[model samples]
Target: MPTHNDPDTFTFFPVLIGDIGGTNARFAILLDAYAEPKEFPILATADFATIDEAIQSGVLDKTSLQPRSAILAVAGPIKGDEIHLTNCDWVIQPKGMIRDLGFEHVEVINDFEAQGLAAASLEPEYLEKVGPGETHPSLSRVVVGPGTGLGVSGLVHARHTWFPVPGEGGHIDIGPRTARDYELFPLYEPIEGRISAEQVLCGRGMMNIYHAVSKANGTEPVAANPAEVTALWSQGRDSAAVETIELFATYLGRVAGDLALIFMARGGVFLAGGIAQKILPALRQPHFRAAFEDKAPHSELLGTIPTFVITHPLAALSGLAAYARTPIRFGVATEGRRWKA
Candidate 1:
């Protein structure tokens, strides 16, 4: 163990959190619960050989930062103690981890679930509007993010209380809205056999959409990576890139709209993940809202729901911290009480 940093090093007490995704695990310390998260340090998970190596070495020193609670926003489906990180190379046992980390409270939640919690604590400056309407703070909020993979979760506010509902809604077969989108279905079969919404809405999915469209349209795509495409789209370099971003935004809107309908999250929608931040300009187009409100007849309903993108980079850490300290009351593990999620 590394020796703890001198007490004088930190002027305030911050809760330590790790946002572990399929590609990146963001480690941060939060001084203020969710309002403002000071980015202490960011580490590329690939830099370390193992997840534990990176976190234990960077956050757990005998001295500098003291976090009594910890929450891990993980990418995979959170069942029980054994967590399988979808985009990562590891599965974790919470009991073992909590014990080894020496944390009095430790909780693991799906990345989307954490994102939902993070959404509740966002500051006004940390958000960018993707569509045309303002969010109604009193209504339920939906959280969607696209990174190495697409993650979805919701928060319903009733009488001023926010309740988080986490699900594997991302894995369902995607409902393609257009003929060109129909061709995109088979393209994902080789990987998932059954394409989930994320197959076309996330990081790699952006490439999939680009390549699929390129092949379908018989036009050579100019961009090399999704980032390049997003950059070019933002700069108005390639119309095709613009088209790709449109498709991405459209599909994302479809998914969000669907989730909103499912959860009846009439309050608002929260868009997160590292991807949305990069594609903000692209999402401002007319196509974004068109897809969002394309709901049958009830299109007027979507118009009322507000959508906001999470601009805070470390926003999800708050959710992880909250998860660690809150106990599950039933079904999945309530031997004396219950278990689930």
Candidate 2:
């Protein structure tokens, strides 16, 4: 397989890195392989016709240096050269980007995988602890979050290296595990008689939770969107919205805990994505950690694993830069296409 040359040796002073999501696309310039990345304003995905257009108008047209290599962490599944984003219409093609954008190398990967890659390297200020317990460096770490949809991935540590494994774990079936869970289940109709975790964990999930809670309490649902729900919850103006966010955090903790058990993530569980960052207070609630630690037989072990919310805006971009520098070290390029210089 062809490989991109070391970016540090390239004539271009900065390499391009991007994090594309349903709501916004963020681009940055990695001045050095290991230095802080310089980022541009977040571009609304609705404003652009294609991913290339966003990059061209937002980053390339504004910056002077010509980037030879690029890595984009997109919010979708990357099957091969062609990738379809989960929550938007943007389709990314690696070969087309290279041919049309004059890039020597271009790679696209799942957004959560990028978050997993950046989990270990995230600065202290960018992380906000959710529960207690220190990280076990030798064990795996799990990354899960909800934005346009829920994303799930894991990081494995071996031979002093970290490798990110991204997957569609959010589509797993979700059921009632507690009384609160049972109460919320009857509100929304399921897809094929089943409720995927994404149905109750993402932006739509929050709305579902709010509407369900309202119906259960004999009150008509009034919230318009997840933002409105969160805003109402923050201001303590809407009880139904508050309950929805509380249940959102609790259920998220339950899923995070389940994933931690699956991966034996003693290193930690990192809550990522835009929604996770917005609801830090809810995540810090006792119900959140309680649900996370409620697992039996291994509750002690679960208690030993710490959890955190990723507050860094450029985490995925940083991880892409890291992967660009040493793809083998990260071991994430096995599936995604890599254009060699």
Q: Mind giving the per-residue lDDT tens digits that candidate 2 earns over 4-38?
A: 33443232435788889888898888776666677
Off by over 4 Å in 2: 1-13, 326-328
Please give me the total number of clashing residue pairs in predicted model 2.
Answer: 0
Would you list the C-alpha lDDT of every candidate in the order shown?
0.69, 0.83
Which number leads on TM-score?
A: 2
Q: Write candidate 1's Cα lDDT for 1-341 as tens digits.
A: 11112221111235556788877778766554443444446767778777667778766652365655455677887665677788887776656655676544455656777787777656688877766666667677788888888888878766445566778777766766688667766655335366678777888888888777777778888888888988888888877677788988998888888888887776678888778888887677777778888898778888877778888867777555443333221101112111111
Candidate 1, run of 10 with poorest lDDT: 330-339
Give the Cα error of residue 45 in candidate 2, in Å.
1.2
TM-score for candidate 2? 0.93
List RMSD in Å for every model shown: 6.8, 2.5
